[model samples]
Target: MEIQKNLIQLGQSFKTKEEAITFCGEQLVSGGYVTPDYVPAMLERNSELSVYMGNFIAIPHGTDAAKKEVLKTGITIVQVPRGVNFGDEEAPKIATVLFGIAGVGSEHLDLIQKISIFCADVDNVVKLADATTADEIADLLNSVEV
Candidate 1:
């Protein structure tokens, strides 16, 4: 899975989706995957469009213009076991998993596909949400193939 090679923070507790977004975005930027501007770009884009990808997962990606900010293709996954609201009122929509992806060109499609495969099974998503540690979460994703 695309997430296997990227940074992962598990069992985190963020009071808001914005907090989670900022945390993960900064991580990606610091890791040299994306420019610092990409973080704010992602937040702005998310404000325009909901990133909730179903199954209690919110995937935040930079705007098309912000693509220039990406230096490498990678994903920073932040799992908040307590969950965070993503501008939704539905009870099932509070996302417990946050996936911040930096895609270079067509890499976005591949990255999306990888995430689709990773979340194809509800049980897998549930297992991922309930994972106790970053290592466990990484091992779970690393065990899957896109």
Candidate 2:
């Protein structure tokens, strides 16, 4: 599936998980990707998907009725100065967070799989955590061939 560059920019600018989810939902709504009212539910779902891997990376995502109905498929990147706890026993600081929202019936599993592979690389996640701008993050993402 073709990655939506605009969605990546929307994700990169969020400072908090709540903000990230809200912004992603808003983008889905405005872009006709999802309904606006699905934001809260999406947040609730994201809370459960939060995972903090070592090296300052957090991936919080959910594919529930609200998210699946609204998002279709998109990715959002968020940077937190102090990082957030992902509910792990270690609860490591997640300096950078990425949300991958997939809607029902969307066949972008390849893109999602590629993103997962990219995030699994410690070096790439480290670089993403340190990215200073949305464009830089987007560029990094684009550099990865899905």
Clashing pairs in 2: 11-76, 11-77, 34-70, 72-103
Model 1 lDDT vs. the true structure?
A: 0.81
Tens-digit lDDT string for candidate 1 (79-142): 8887888865655468888888888898977877788778878888898888877777777877
Model 2 accuracy (lDDT, Cα): 0.58
Q: Give the Cα error of residue 64 in candidate 1, in Å.
A: 0.3
- lDDT by residue for model 2 (60-129), tens: 4444555446546555555555555544346445545554454545444555567678878878877777
lDDT of each: 0.81, 0.58
lDDT (C-alpha) at residue 50 in model 2 = 53
Index of the highest-lDDT prediction: 1
In model 2, how large is the Cα lDDT of residue 146?
Answer: 43
- After best superposition, candidate 1 residue 82: deviation in angstroms? 0.7
